[model samples]
Target: MQTRTNTFIAITSLFIALGCNQHKESVEPKNGGATEKTIEPTNKVVLSSDIVWQKLNPARGDQSPQAGTIWGNRNGKVATGFLAKFTDGFSSPPHIHNVTYRAVVLKGTIHNDDPKAEHMWMTPGSFWTQPQGEAHITSAKGDENIAYVEIDHGPYLVKPTDKAFDNGERPINIDASNVVWLNYEKSEWLAKDSKAEISFLWKSHTDDALQGVFVKLPKRFNGKLHSTGNIFHAVVVQGGLDYTLPQTNEIKALDIGSYFTSSDRALHSIANTSDKETILYIRTNGSLNIDNK
Candidate 1:
């Protein structure tokens, strides 16, 4: 009878031990089987200090910019950028982002359109915006490789390029004869920097619409500050920026290929803290919801 009792107690204890181990595993973070665990910020992912933005190559004939974007997604943050290469034609099929896009052609000419605009030619230093839901078509022209910065609400590409548009659609055409010149030019301040050429892109009438400014703030420019949709995000495609928040007075220095967001309800701006010209692509919208602040 004593042996039976002992066996029952042992079984019960064994079950208890197993249960405790299972609970521990469920609560523990999967940190590559290491005992050390990293605690993420309350509402953010802090990229490593050494994490630099690097140019990504798209497939041939797709917008595979030779010198292009180094970017990040700031979880509902207000911004994103793509440094497109002119050497390789942008190859992705027509697609749309969760938000609208503002673009500035830094060098070479970019062809863009939908069934509506047909082939609209965008030249170097030209800035423009496209609304969400608008089908985008693209190709690069001219000998010089083109580079540009784009700004938009991120987590942008929601669908695969292959499924985004109907097949058999033709590329847009540019009427070299009727190219409407907005007569827009870079900011005088930016011109003096030599490395930077700053110019305002199109502005939106609605609160949630996409808006942006093109800047070639190479070593000449450090940073500029502005409020974007609801959240503030920054990108360092070429050099770097010391991003600061007006509300919190917090500063984050991000390098090339690095990005930072100032959080919702925070007033944020980017500054060129380094000697190298800090090329930038920036966009600001009121809120992603379009109706809400």
Candidate 2:
């Protein structure tokens, strides 16, 4: 375990730090002829409803599934996170992508394995990885099939099976129930008194490798993902919560598929005030300290 003890440090940051805060506000000035103006920082947020869908394979045209990007650009050479939606009973012919990627099933069920492998359905919360140039077939079941896919860097492209070549990394398909977790008592981030848990999914191969992790919040749980990293990405993979930034109380729905990125030290307050648990999938190059409340 290469866990970085975040007494003060952790997760992986994204490929780029993207944010724009051009919000403007007007207010009455006591002794001014015109109202005073103020600018508000609209946190870097990308919602599913706002995502621009594109064909996963432009060449395949309508024959391909849809991809909705959350952060970065899959067509560009940079780390990216996006959603893949497949129609029910959808299955792809044998194919390979140019880059290795990590994926998490968010809705319905997905089966991603070798072309000749038997179907192994993975339900919501399941995690899987596809090595670069690995030949595989992706199949989906149920009416609403969606999964969160991420890449370390891209120009993500689908290629014919003959182009497949080993990158030395093997594929892993872990059912949700098979996930091993570290409870609050064992983790350094969560409050020892809280019932939250965390699970690490992957870590990049670079010296300052980014980490992909899942943090599960108990019902009504409130906390902050206090971290010093300048580049980070947090996506709601399960359930929902209110996300607020430092010096700002304007909380917004951090529901599934709604994500926010940051390029500076972040003190993001999150709360799962609902009755159900909420899970956040965070990627960063540094560690985090949870301010349990």
Candidate 3:
């Protein structure tokens, strides 16, 4: 708790010294000439359309009769993306992942009823993880197709079953050691040492491009001074934070679920001002190495 308190005060001082101009920056495209535009996205609303299957991209990762891919690892480590489209009322047989599996639902509904008896229904924004040797079954319901993001830990996609669909009448038994949940309630606060081993469900690692990672910060904790890609932004998905600019030694009080972007070439840190934990989803578009800085 003392470390948390120190973190909060440190972030506050950084914010105050930063005044108000440290959170805004202009982003330039990698090839130069073109300027990047920022659009404040609004909440998603469900609507009805009769277009049937929409092939967003030709090639992604792997496509099967019941499963189709969207995007996957393009150039090995530099870029990666993968997605699957499940047909209506399609249920895949129980299968196992020989390698780690990371996936997120883009649309429709998917149920993964392993490790627990309860049926877990995932919507469009849901993300899930399946470790190697973990066996599970999946399916899509209703008239629409189920789309998802998949990132494999190995070179190829591995499954225990050749059939993609299986009826939910009988249960399939397999090893339950590495099974994990992607959707979890944020903790009150997370310390560096107390940080849990979170599963990388689906991560698209792209150099010089923006990547989003979900992180939880415990209450009353201050953050360390760090720099990544020359520019960075932190959005409070939940709770509030008292932020600090490391270089300027200024601080400011930000409310719950607010948005803050760092200034150009400004060293920065953050703290949790609320009693509850702070949850943040961050995206950065430049080199993340800060050793020289």
The sequence of per-residue lDDT tens digits that candidate 3 reaches over residues 124-157 is 4344555555556666775554443333333434
lDDT of 2 by residue, 104-213 (tens): 99999999988888788888888888888888899998988989999989898889999989878777777787666666555555544758777777766784446777
Residue-wise lDDT of candidate 1 within 1-293, one digit each (tens)?
00111233333443333222322221111222111221221112233344333444444434444443434442346454555555544434565544555555555677666534445556544444455555666567777544444544565443434444333322222222222221112222221223434333334455424444334444433333323234444444456666554445577766544555444322234466567655544544432100001
**Local distance difference test, each candidate:** 0.42, 0.72, 0.40
RMSD of each: 23.0, 10.0, 15.2
Candidate 3 error regions (>4 Å): 1-79, 161-211, 214-293
Better of 1 and 2 by lDDT: 2
Report the backbone clash tally of model 2: 12
* Per-model TM values vs. the true structure: 0.40, 0.82, 0.37
Q: Which stretches of model 1 miss by more than 4 angstroms?
A: 1-71, 74-78, 88-92, 115-118, 147-151, 158-211, 214-293
